[model samples]
Target chain A: MSKYAELFATESRDHLTAMEHALLELESAPADRSALDALFRSVHTLKGMGGAMGYGTVSTLSHAMESLLDRVRSGQESLTPPSIETLLQATDALASAVAASTTGRESALDISTLLTRLAVPAAPAQGTTRVLQIVLDPGTPLPGARAQLIVGRLARVAEIVRVEPDVAGMESAQFTGEFTVQLRSAEAIEVLGDAARAAGFVSSLVEVVPRDEVRQTPLSVDATWNTGDLQAPLQKYVRIESRRLDGLMDLVGELVTMRDRLQVVASRHGDPALDEAVAKAGRLIGELQDGVIGSRLVPVWQVFDRFPRVVREAARAAGKEAVLVVEGREIELDRSLLEQVADPLVHLLRNAVDHGIEPADARVRGGKAVEGRVLLMARRERNSVVVVVADDGRGVDRQRVLAKARRLGWVTDDTEMLSDDEVLRIIARPGFSTAEQVSEVSGRGVGIDAVLAKVRGLGGAVEFSSVEGKGTVFQLRLPVTLAIIPAIIAQVGAESYALPLTHISETVQPAAGALRRVQGRPVFVLRGQVLPLYSLRALVGAAGRDPEGQQIVIVEATDRRAAVLVDRLVGQQDIVVKSFDLVRGMSAGFSGAAILPDGTAALILDAGGLL
Target chain B: MSRQLLVVSVAETLYALPSELVREITTLPSQVTRLPGAEPSIRGLINVRGQLFPVMDLCHRLRGVPGNEAVDVLVVVSDGKTLGLLVDDVRDVIPMDEPAASVTAPDEADTSVVRGVGHSGEMVVIELDVPKLVRSSLA
Candidate 1:
C-alpha cells in the first residue's frame, strides 16, 4: 500500500468501528437520537472517503447505508431489528472493500443484496427541508452562470422546493453571486457541501437546518463540525512509528551512561569550572531521560475502547444479557505494558460475562435486574495500576470446585473448607479444569492458568475472590512502566543485584536472636510473624557473605512475604531494564539486566519467583 | 562462494567465522559480573557501552579445555541477538575463493558449531557456524 493508502485504510477502519458501536447502542435503545446521529455521520464520512479514493463499490454501499440512516434521523422510517442487522452486514462489507482496496485489489463481495435491502424508498419524506445559503467569489465573470450551476448540482440530490430568484433575474446582470436555494432532502450537510464544491468555486455555504434540528445538532463536536475537521487529525497529530521511539529511548540510555562517565572524569580532575559544567550536564541529561520515557506513555483508553464490543459479543454467544461499565479510562501507562495487558483483560471480561453473570431468567428470579452488569475499572495504587473485573451474577459454586480439586489431588480430601486464597491457587493450576468440574467458569474459555502466566510474566500480580450467590471479582495489579524503574542495589560477595522498589516493603537489621530456625527452615521474627528468610549465598551461589552484619529486605509478592539477606545495601537509583531473554538456559529467577551507575551490569531480581 | 573470514584461537586451536557476523573484537572489560550457577562454559555478563551481553568462554565450550589464557572478546550477532565469544589472542583475517570442505565425523561431539574445515596456506582452520554456535551455547 502507498503511504496515502495506509492512512485511508486506518481511517476507514476507525469509522467502521464507530458505526458498529453506534449500531449496538441503537439495538439497545431504538429511540436514542444521538446514537442515530453518530451512525449517520460515520457512514457519511466513509462514503465521502470511499468516493475520493475511487473505490466505487465502497462508496456505493456506504451511500445506500447513509440514505437509510438519514431517513431514520428525519422521522421518515424507524429503526427495526431487521434494518439494524442489514446495516451491520453492510458495514462489514464496507470494511472488507476498504481492506481490499489497500492491496490494490477489487473486492469480490456481492453487495447487491445488502444494497437492495438498504435502498427501500422512505414512506413520504416528512419534515426533511434544508436551506443552502450560497456565495461565490466577488468580481467573478459569469456570476449568473455560476449560480445556475450550483442550483443544477444540488437539484440531483433533493427536490427543488423553492429558489429565491426567477430565471430572468438570474440571467440579468442585477443578480449578485448570493442566493438562497431551499431543497427538501434527507441527507447530511456534508453531502450538500460535496455537491456544491463539485460545481464551481463556492466561497461560502451554510446549512440553515430547522429549529429543533439545530438545537439537537450540538454545534461543537457534532456531525457538521467533524466534517470540517476531517483533514484536521492528519494535520494535527504527527504519527511517529513506535520503533523510532524505541530507538530514541536507547540513545537516551546511552547518553545517561556517558553522563555518568563524564561525572567520574570531572571528579578526578578536581577543577571547579569543569565540575560545575559536568553537574549541569548531569541535571540536563536526567531531565532528558525523563522526557523520553514520558513520551512512551499513552492513556488506557487506547486498549479499553475495543472491550465493550467484546462484552456484548460474549454475552450474545452465551444467550445472556450483559452490560459492560468502564471507568478510569484516562489513566496512563507504558504503551507496551498496556498492550500486553489487553489480552488478559479480554479473557477476564469474557469469563465474567459467561460465568459470573446469571441468565436473564435466573437474574429475574433472584430479585435482580434482568440485564447483568460487568464493571471494568483501572485505578492507580502507589506505583502500580490495579484493574478490576467484577460482575453481578451467580457467585462461584465452591462445592463443585472443592470436589474437583480433591479429585485432582490439588487439595487434600480431608481438608474441610478452602479459603479464597486456596481456591484461587487450585483453579490457577496448569491443568486444573475438567469437563465435569465447573464453578462460575464452565471451563469453556481460556484457561485461567494462561491468564495468570501472562500477567505474572510482566512482573504483575493477580487477586481473586468469590462470594456464593453474589458474584466474583478479579483484580490484576501491574506496574505503571517496565522499561525504567527505581531499584534498590544490594551487594553479595563480589556481585551486585538490583531489587525493584515496587516489591520491597522495608529493610531491617535483624537482632542476633531475632533470626531463628522453625522446623529447620530459616525464619525471621518480624512483628510476631515468622517470615521465611532466604540468604543471598544460597539463592545466587555467592561463595560467602559477612556473618557479622546481615541486612534483611522484606519482600511481598503474591500474598507471600519473605525476608532476603544480603551483605550490604549499596544504594538506590533508577535503572533502565533491558530484555535478557536472548540468553537461553540461564537461571530462571532473574527478571532482566540493567547497567549500574558505576558502569557495570547487574541482574534485576524477580520478586514473584524469589518469594 | 567467496567470503571473508575472521580467524581466532582458543587454547591453541584455530577457528574461522564469517566476517559479516562479527560485530567487533575488543579487550574484556574490567567488570564481568559472575553468574555462579550457569554452565561451566558460561563465564558471566559484560556491559559494552550500555547493553548487557552474555560472554562465553569459547575454549571451554567447544573443546572442553578451560580458557586459562583467554583475554580477547569477539562480539557477534545472530538473528538480531548478540553473544560474546571469549578467545585467547588476536588472529588474522583471510579471503577465500572457494568454500570450505564439509566435515561429517561420527566421533564429533558438537556438530552444531564445527560443520566444516578449511585451509589457509597449509594451516588448518575450523569453519564455525555462528548462528548455530550461538543457539547451541545458549541451549
Candidate 2:
C-alpha cells in the first residue's frame, strides 16, 4: 500500500478508537453532554475525512454513526446499552474498512442495518431557532469568500435563521473575522462544525455555547448573546509508520559505525586536520541523530487517553466504584515502547478494578471512601521512563501469596529465606493467582506473566510494592530509548564482552581474602552484602583457568545483584544494540553485538538471560 | 592423485575439521576464567580481540582428553555469538576429492562425532559434524 493510504488508515483508526472510548464513557453517564459532544465531534470528523480520502464505505458508515450520535447528543434519544453496542460494532466495521482499504481491498462490511436501528423518531417543528456563531481565524485570507462558502455549506445541514452583518455590510462591519449564523435545524453542534470545516474556513474551532450551555440560557429564539463558533484546529500530530522509523534508525546505526571508522582512521594516521574535521562532523551527526529520533517520541498521554473509559467500563462490569486518576500523561516515550506498555497498563487497571478495589459496601465497612482511585503516573528518570500503576484499595495479601506459593510448590520448606520481592516475583509467574475464585475479568491466573514478559522484552524492569490494607503499586522502569545503551566492555578470558551499564550495580576489585565459598557458590563481600559470583569464563565455555586475581563487575538483574568475575576491565562505551537473533540462533548470554573502537565485535552480555 | 587434507593433532590423534566451519583464528589468552559449576567441556570464556565470547575446549569436548598445554593458537569458530569453539590449532584449508565413505572409528572415539572415514591418499580423514559435535559436548 502507498504511504498516504497508510497515513489515512492510521488517522481513521485513531478517530474510531476515540469514538469508541467516548461512547463507552457516555454509556455509563448518559447525561454527560461533554462526552456526547466529543463523541459526536469524532464521528463527524471521521465522516468528512473519509469522504476526502474517497473511502466511501468509511464515510457512509461514519455518516450513519454521526446521525445517531447527533440524536443522542441533542437529548432526543437516550443512550442504551444496545445503542452503545451498535455504535461499537459500527466502529469495529469502520476500523476494518480502513484496514482493508490500506491493504488495497474493498471492505464488504454493511452497517446500514445497525445504523437504521439507531435512527431516532423526528420531532415536530415547533418554530424553535438556534444560532451557531461562526468564528474564523482572523489570519484566514479571502474572508468574505470564506464566509459566503461557510454559509452555503451550513444551508445544506440547517436552515439559516439569520446571518449577522447582513451580507452587504459583512465587509465593512467590525467582524473580528467572526460571524453568527442562526440555524433553525435540530442538528448537533458537532455536525454544524463538521459542515463548516467541510467548507474549509473554520480553523481552531470549538462549540463555545454547547447544547448544555444553551439549555441553561433561557433564550427563546430572540436571545441577544455573543456566540462564537470555535474553529476546529488542524491536528498538530501526524502518524508515521513504525517500519519507516525503524528504517531511519538502521541508517543512523550505519552512520554511527561509519563515524567510528572515520575517527579510527583519523587517529591512527595522526592527522590533526582530518581529526578536527571528523570530530566536528561527528558532533553534528550526533545532534542530528538525536533530533531525528526524538521526533518519533510521543507523549504517554496518547495511550493513557484510552484508559479512562477502560477503567470506567471495567469498574461497572465488576460492580465496583473506582476512579482512574492519570498524572504525567505528557511524559514522552518512544511510540513503540508506549504501544508495548499499553497492554500491561490495561491489565493492571483491570486487575485494580476487579480484584484490588473493594465493592462499595466492603469499602464502607473498611472505613475507606466509596470511590476507589487507581492512579497511573509516569515520569522521566535519568535515561528511563518510570510508570507506576497504584490503586487505593486492599493491597496484595502477603499471607495469601506465601500460602499460594507453598501450595503451588514454588517455594520450598525454607520459605522464610525467600524475600518479599522473590515472593512477589512468583506472583508474576505463570498460573499463579492469589484471587480466591476465578473471575471473568482477571482471576483466571493470566496476564501478569505476559505483562512481566513485555516489560522485560522492552529492556525494562517491573517491581511491586504493597501495603496489605493500603494498596499495591506496580512500578515499571523502562529505558527512554531502545536504540542505544551505555555499556562497559570487559574481558572474559580472551574474549571481550559489553555489559549494559544500566544494570551494573557496582564494580569491585575483590582481593583474595574477600572471596569466600558459601554453599558451593562463590560469594564476594562488598559493602556488607554477599553477592553471588559467576565467572564469565566458565559461563561462556572458554578453555583455560581464570587468572588468580581478577576484578568483579557487580550487575543487577530483576531485583538481585550478582558479581560477574571478568579477566580485565575494558573501558566503557555507548553501543548500538544489534539483535543477536537476526544473525542466527539466540546467543547463550549475549543480548546483542556491537562493534567496538579499533574495529572489532563485542558480545553484549544479557543480564536478564544470566538470571 | 592425492587429496589435500587439513590436519590438527589433539592428544596425538590426527583430527580434521572442515576449514569452512572455522570463522577466525586468534591467540589463546594466558588464562581462561573458569566458571566452577559449568559443564566440563566448557573450558571457560575468553576475550578475543575486544569481545568476550564463549570458548569451548575441543580437546575435552571432542576427544575427552584434558590436556593443560600452553597453546599459542585458538580457533574462534561460532555459529553466532553463542557457541564459540576454541580448537588447539587451525592447520590449513585443503580441498579433498570425493572419497568412499566408510564407518571407521578411531580408538575410544564417540561415533556421534565422526561422520565417516575418507581416505586422503595414505591418511584416513575423519569428517566432523560441527553442530552435532557441539551439541554432544553440551549434553
Candidate 3:
C-alpha cells in the first residue's frame, strides 16, 4: 500500500471531521470568530493534503469547500442554516473522494452538484471592503515566496481577510506572477500602499472596491490568530504507521501469553534465578503491553466531537431546536473500539433528536424550554466507560410503543404492563418502529437492534431508561479496549474456547433431568427461565458426545439468551482478540480468535450468534 | 518476453502465479489457528513475524479437499491484502516464453477465480487469478 495514500486518507478524514464540527458550531453561533477560523484551517489542510496526494478530484472538492468557508469567514456570504447544510454535504463529498482515491477504486463521486451550489453569487461585500491586487515583477525569482513577504507586511497594517490562490496553490507556483489580496483596514490607500511598497518585488498594486461604500465591521483577524485558532502551532508528533503499532501490539500480545507460560514454568521448576528472571520478564511484558495499548488510547472526543453536527442535522431534519451538550470527552478509549462505536453513537444521537426530543412548540407547551436539550455525557465507571445520550424532550410514548409491540406480535395481549427495561428491549428489536410511517428523521425500518448488535459485537452493552413526556437516556457501557477483552475460557471436547465475559449472565450446572428436548432442540431450565442450549463441540464441528455433567454458560445477546454447554470451565483471563479474514463470511459463529495463556489460539464465541 | 512465475503445488495440481505477486514463501506455521465460523477454505490465522494474516488453504479452494498439508506457504499480495496460500509444496520459479494461453476457460461455476491454463514446456500450469480469487474468497 502507498504510504501517501494512507496519509492522505487519514489526514483528510481528520479535516472533514473538524470541518463538520466547526460548521455545526457556526450554525449555532453564526458569527463565532474562532469557529470560522477553525473551519477555514480544516478546509485549507484538506486542500493541501489532497493536492499533495495527487487526488485532483478530492483536492478540487476541498478547494470548493475552502472557497465557500472563506466567503463565510469574510462575511461576503451569509452563514445561513441552508448554506451550512450545503457545506456539510460538500465536506462529506470530499471525505468520500479521499476514501475513493486511497482505496485504489475510482469513485463516481461527482462534485459538480456541490460546486454549482457553491458558485452561486454570495452576498455582495459590505461597505468599502476592497481587494488589493498585487503583481510581482516578471523577473521575480520566486513569486510564491515574494507573495508571502507581501502578505506578511500587509497583515500588520490590515486584516488579510482572504488571499487569492491560497497558500498551497501559491507555494506550488500554480499562480501567475500576479495575485489578489483582500484586506479590511481603516488606513487610506496611500498609507497601506507604503507597506506594500516596503515588501518590494511588487511590480504594481491596484485596489478594486464594491459599489456600496458602507464600511464593513472591523475584522477579527488579530483576535482569531492570537487565540491560536488560525495560527495554532504544529505540535511535535511522529506519525508512526498504525500497522507498525499493530504489529508491535501483536508481538506484545504474544509476549503477554508467553509471560503467563513462563510464570507457570517458573512455579514448577522453582529455581531462584529462573523465578527472578521470569518475574522480571513478566513485569516488563506487562509494561510493554500497557504501553502498546496506551498508544492506541485516544480521547473520546475524536468520536464525540462529531455528534454535535449529527444532532444539529437531525434537529434540522425534524424541524426542532435541540442542543447537544457532550461531557467527559477527555475520557480515552481504544482507537479501534472508538471507531466501532462511532456509528452507534451517531444513530443514538439521531434517535434522541428524532424520537425523544419534541419540536420547539410542543416542548414549550409542556412547560419546558422551547429549545430541547440532548446531553451526550461519558464517564469512566470502575472498569467500563459509560456513555449516556439523554434527551430532555418528550420521552418514548409508552402506550404507543406497547400498542405497536402488541400489533407486531412481539408481545401477547395477555402480557402484563412492561417495565422500562422491557419496553426498551421491545423497541430495540429489529423492524420495531412505533412511528406510523417511515420518516426521514428516525423511522426507516431498521431500529435500535442494529445499534445493539454493533455494541454487542464490540463487547459492549446498551441499556435505556425513559419516562413518558419527560426524557429518555440510552446508556452504553463499553470496554476500554477491543484488542484484549476479559473472557471466560471454557474447554469443550479437546479444544478450548473463550466467551466474552460481558455476554455471560451466569454459569450453572443444570441437573440431568433439567435438560429437556422440545421440537428436537435441547434446552436447560434454571429456576423459572428456560434457555435454548447449544453444544459447544457440535457447533465447532468437533467429534464428541455430550459430557456427563454439562456446564451451561448462560449468554445474552440483544433479545435472547442461550445456554452454551461446554465440557468444563477452564478459567477466566484477558484475551487478545484477533479478527478473522472477513471474507470467511460468518465462520461458524465465532466473533474473533484470541491467544490463550498457553500461546495457542482459541476461537472467541459470539453469544449473539449462538441464539 | 519471458514471464517469471512462481510454481506452487496444491493437492497434486500445479499452479503458476506471477512472481511479483508472491511476497515470500515460508514453511507452513505449525500453529495456524482455526476460526470458528470461517469457511473451510480459510484454515484460520497465522502470525508471521508478529503480523497476523489469514491463511487460505489452496487445496480447499481448488479441489474442495481439506488442506492438511504441513508444507510451505506462499504469501501473496492479492487485492492489496497479504494472505497465506497453503500450498502442498512450493516448486521452483520458472520462466515461460509466452503469455498464459487462454485455451482453458474459467470453471463454469466461478468465471474469474481461475484464469486460463498455461503450458510451461513439459509442465502444465493452471494460472491462478490473484485478484479475483482474493475478492471472491475474502468476500
Candidate 4:
C-alpha cells in the first residue's frame, strides 16, 4: 500500500459520509440554514483537502459545490428540491473523483453541467431579497477603477439598490472604507459576496435584507444588487484520517491482549508483588483500550442521517407519502463496521420506502394513516450492534413468495413439509425476485442478495420477518468490531480448530441413547427439539474411521442450531484471525487459518459456511 | 534428430518427465490425511512446518500399485504453491541422442499415464503427463 493511500481512503470516506448526512438534511428541511451551512462546510473542507493532496479534479468539483453552497447559505439564493438533486449529483461526482485519486487514475469530473444547473436563477417566486453590504479594511488602498468594476458585477444579480457615497456625495468626502446596500432579489446572499471577492475588492459583506426593510416590492425578474461591503470570517473545521484512529485501535488491541496474558500469568504464579503490578497494569490497559476504541465509535446517526433524503426521493418516485422516524441514532459502533454496514442499511431503508410503504390512497383504504412510517433503530447488544429497519405499511405477501417458489421449482411436494423459516430462506436465495415489475430504485433482485452477502461476509447475520398488512422488519446483527473476536478452540480429529464463540450456543455431550435418525440424518434431542449433527472429521476430511463417540458442539446460525461432533474438546482460546485467499475450486469447510499456541496452523471454521 | 531425457520408475515402467518440471526432492510424511469424497491420489491437506499444504501420491495418480510404506522422498513442485509429490525413487539424469521416430502407446499401456515415447539407443523413455495422470486419477 502507498504511504498516503490509507490516509486518502480514510479522509475520502469521512468526506463522503459528511456529504451524505448533509444531503439528507437538505432534502427534508431544504430551507434549514444550519443544514446548508453544514453542507457548505463539508464541501469546502473536501475541496481544501483534495487540493492539498493534488487531486485536482476532486478539488475543482468540490470547489464548484462550495461556491454553490456559499450562494445558498448567504440567502442570495433559495434552495429548491431540484437544487438538492444537483447537490446530490455533485456529491456523487466528488466521491468518484476521490475514488480515482486513491487508485492513481485520473478522473474526468464533468461537474460543469451540475454547476450550471446550480447557477440557474432561483424560481421567480422563491427569490431572495438581496442586501448589499460592503466593508473595506482601512489597510488597503483601493484604486477607483477596480472598485467600480466590483460594484458593476454586483449590479447584474440585483438592482444597484444602494451605493454608499452617492456620486455627488463622493466628491465631497473620502469613502468611509465600508458601505451597505438594501436591494431585492431572491438569489442566495453568498453569491453576491463571492462576486465581490472575485472582483478584487479588499473586503466584502453580504446578507439578505427583508423586502419590507427595503420598502420596495422587487419585481420577479433577474436583477443584481450591489452592496460594497466586507464579508465576515468563514467558520472552519478540521478533517482527520481514520487510519490514525485505526492505528490507535491496533495499539489498543495489543494492549488488551497483553493485559489478558499478564493476568493469566499473574494468576497462575500467584506472587503478591507481581499481583499488584499486574493489577495496576491491567487497570491502565483497560482504561487505555476503552478510551482508544471509544474514539473510533461513531454514532449510528452518521448512517441514519442520510435516510430522510432517501425516503423522500424514493417516496416521490414510487408515488407514495412516507415519514421516516429514526431512534437511537446516538448508538455508536466501531467506525470500520459502520462504513461497511452503511450501504446495506441504506438499501434496506430504500426497500422499506419503495416496496414496504404503500401509496397514500392504498394506505388509507387499508385503514392506515395516509402517510407511511418507516422506523430505523440502532442499539447495542452483547458484543454486537443490532440495526433494525421497520415500516408500517403493507407487509410481505407470503402467498406470493410461496407461489413464486413453486413456479421456480424451488418448492416441491416435499417442500410442503418444510417450515416457514425454510420457505423464507428460499426467498432470500440469489436471483429470487417476487416483484411483478421492476422499479428504478429497487426490485432488480440485486441489492438484497448483496446486502445478505455483505452482512454474512462481515460475519454478521440478517433476519427478516413480516406480518401481512402490517409491515416488514429487517434486523441486522453485526459484530461490534472486526479486528478481534472471541473464539472457541476445539480438536477435530487430530487437528485443532477455532470457531467463533459468538456462533456457539452451547456445547454438550449428547447422550448415546438420545441419538435418533431423522430423514436419514443423525440428530439429537436438545430441549425436546431435534438438532442435526454433523461429524467434524467428515467435514474436515480427516483420515481413518470415525470415532465411535464424540463430544458435540452446538452452534447457532441465525435461528437454526446444529451439533458439530468433534473427537475431543480442547477448550476455548481467543485466536487472532488471519485470512487466506481461497484456492480456486477449493471448497473446504473453513473460512481462514490461524496460528495455535504451539505455533501450529489451524483452519478457522465458518458457521455460516456450513449452511 | 536429438533428445535429452531423465528416466524414473513407477511400477515396472520407465517414465520421463522433463527435468525443468522437477522442482525438488524430499521425504514424505509417514501418515497422510484422507479426504473423504476426494480422489484416491489426493493424500489430503498436510501441515508442512507451520504452513498448511496439500500432498499428492504420484504412484496412485500414475495407476501403479499404491504403496503402503511411508514415502522415502517427496518431490516438491510449484503449481502456485509447493505441492508435495511422492515418488518411489530418483534415477540418474542422463542425456540422450535422437534415435528413431517417437511411437504411440499400445492398448496394454495406460495411454492416460504416458504422453509419448522417446527412443535413445536401446532404452525407450515414456514421457509422463502430470495433468493427464492427475485427471485420470481424479476421475
Best by TM-score: 1
Task: In candidate 3, list every pair of residues with a backbone clash.
Answer: A127-A214, A583-B138, A587-B37, A587-B38, A588-B36, A588-B37
Candidate 4 residue spans exceeding 4 A from truth = A1-65, A68-240, A244-292, A414-420, B1-139
**Model 2, A286-314: lDDT tens per residue?**
88779867977888977997899899988
Worst 10 residues of 2 chain A by lDDT: A221-230
Q: Model-by-model lDDT, in order?
A: 0.79, 0.71, 0.76, 0.68
Across A364-469, the per-residue lDDT of candidate 1 in tens digits comes to 9999999999999999998888998999989778888899888888777798887777778787887776445454433555677888888877878888889987
TM-score between candidate 1 and the true structure: 0.69
Q: Please tell me which model should have the higher lDDT, number 2 or number 4.
A: 2
List model 3 lDDT by residue over A1-611, tens digit each.
46446645656656777888998787666657898899889888878777766788778877887788777667666564345656766766666666667766534556666787666643333333557878888878878888898999998888888998888877884678778888777565555667987989888776653324422422222121122222212423345778888778777877877787778778998799999999898888888888988898878887897789899999999899999999998898888889989988888889888888888888878999988899998899866888899999788888888888888888989876877778878888887787665779767655798988888788777777888898998889898887777889998776888999877888998886878887888888888678788888878777668778768898985446888888999888778888745554645467777777656677788776565
Provide the DockQ value for model 1. 0.38
Which candidate would rank higher by lDDT, 1 or 4? 1
TM-score of each prediction: 0.69, 0.56, 0.66, 0.55
Highest lDDT against the true fold, candidate: 1
Q: Candidates ranked by TM-score, best first?
A: 1, 3, 2, 4
* All candidates in order of lDDT, best leading: 1, 3, 2, 4
Q: Measured by TM-score, how close is model 2 to the native structure?
A: 0.56
